[model samples]
Target: MTPGARIAAAIDILDAITAGAAAEQALTQWARRSRFAGAKDRAAVRDHVFDALRRWRSAGAAGGGQSGRAVMIGLLREDGTDPAQLFTGERHAPEPLSHDEAQVPEPTPARGVRWNLPDWLLPEFAESLGAHAEATAQALQSRAPVTLRVNLRKASRAEAQDALQAEGILCAPNPLCATALTVTEGARRVKQSAPFAQGWIELQDAASQAVVAALPSGARCLDYCAGGGGKALAMAADGRTTFAHDIDAGRMKDLPSRAQRAGAAIRLLDRAGLEQERPFDVVLCDAPCSGSGAWRRAPHGKWTLTPERLAELTAVQDSILDTAKDLVGAGGHLVYATCSVLRRENEDRIAAFLAGHNGWFCRLEQRFDIQQHGDGFFTAHLTRVKL
Candidate 1:
């Protein structure tokens, strides 16, 4: 299909994407009906849809309206392209822009559009990040880097890089962690690449990899809230002997296959099983909270999250920590983590935990801010020092 056709298709998909439909779901639904759209067409259309989402507010401002067509026009304008070229009145292309639409508006940004965030979140970002707030907000407006964790058990960093490069995927060594690689080019082809099929690489963010890398290596470890078991897989890959459990046992259904593919062993346990396997060498709580730090990847969460909802998440986080604490041995480490950039969830929660547990002492480990390498993540290491 012609480039113009892709643009037209993107406009239709964007309507669904902006209206709360999952981006992947909207594209899949569009593909099901449009048999004429090829794989290339679908990928191109998806790019347009995500680009519009990444800069929705600014794009809406440039296009003079918030409709799908206007946002596409705004996107094209931002790229200095003539929208008429795509909105041509030809077959499968969008209808020609109206006379009023033909007039390119001034490049003015929406109020607080630079942050590319909802009005409610602007103050929160500022309060959380302080001086770096604007940069953090601006970073969320762009796509996140495609990061991979080199299965060190399978291959060395240099070996993995060479292997992936041969398969047309360019990966750069990430400074965040020894096992992390940032896919600089051909990232979209990774899933179909030979290395991926062989499980030489796992699509995990560098920041997430860093969190597990910081853990004190132990023979027995438990990921107390192992949602999807990504961190559990990474910890297992490091050969620390990993076990995974979630309050909802169903969340770990795919973990067995994922672990097998990555050549890592993860023991899946339900809440009852976790209770039976107490006093582990290390207990990790990658707790749930407002995913503000990860808004770039899951943009919908930013708009959906509310103050009340955040409060509820923190309560759950605390409970997870309290429950998981009992599973750690007398000399074991109880690690706390969250995807939230908010102080209330990260530092504040840790403070509250220390206050509640008289004998516990925090190791005050590293924290990662959201940037090009990965999403915003916080991890703190603590150990039981007393009765």
Candidate 2:
């Protein structure tokens, strides 16, 4: 397909999203219907749609409307590209911009519009991030880096790098974690690479890998909220006997296969099984949140999150911390973590947990800010106050 054709496709998908269809659902439906579109065409269209979603507010303001065409025009303007190039009246291209659409509006001075976030979230971001809020919001407007964690049990980071390079997938060491590699090129081919097929690497953010690397010494570890078991696999690779449990057991259905591929042993547990396997040396609660830090990968989340939903998530985080702490044995460590930059989900939750639980005290706390290389993350280590 021509570049114009891709932009037209993106406009249609974005329109569906504006009409309440999920971004992924709209993209998938379009792909299924447009059998003539090639892989490159599909990828390009998807990128355009996500870029528009990431800058929804700013794009709407610049284009003077919220329609898909207007958003595309605004997005192009923001990127310094003339909308005329892609909105040409050629076959398979979007309709030519209207006279009004052609006139770019004056820049919006509202921080929420400038930051490409909802108006309600400005105070939350400021409260959570202070001086770094605007920069972090800007970072979410771009693409996230593709990163992989080397399975040290299968190959050293150097050996994994060599194997990936042999397959034409270029990567460089990520500074955030010793085991992480930021994919510099051929990111689309990573899943098909021999090293990945052989379990030498797993797709994970560098900040997520660093959370595991910072874990204290422990013989047994339980990932208390182990959705998909990424951290569980990392813990097992670090030479700990790892166990994984989630309230929804179905979330762990693929964990056994993933564990096998990584040559790591992770025992999956239901509520009953978790009770039987209690008293772990370390318990890691990577609880759910609004996912603000990694919005680059899931931009729709930033738009969909509401104050009520955020309150629900905070309650869940607190409950998970309360429950997981009891499973830690004497002198054991209980670690709380989230992929959110909001203080309500990170520092505030920790403070509430410590206030309610008398015998526990925090030992270490770290925050990974959103960067060109890694997602934002927070982790805190807590230990019992032995009298």
Best by TM-score: 2
Per-residue lDDT tens digits for candidate 2, residues 187-228, read 999999999888899999999999999998999999999998
Query: Per-residue lDDT of 230-302 in model 1, one digit per residue for the tens?
Result: 9998888888888999888888898999898888889998778877888799898999888878878877677
State the weakest 10-residue window (summed lDDT) of model 1. Answer: 105-114
- TM per candidate: 0.94, 0.98
Q: Alpha carbon lDDT of residue 24, candidate 2?
A: 92
Q: Give me the candidate number with maximum lDDT.
A: 2
Would you list the C-alpha lDDT of every candidate in the order shown? 0.85, 0.93
| Model 1 pairs in collision | none
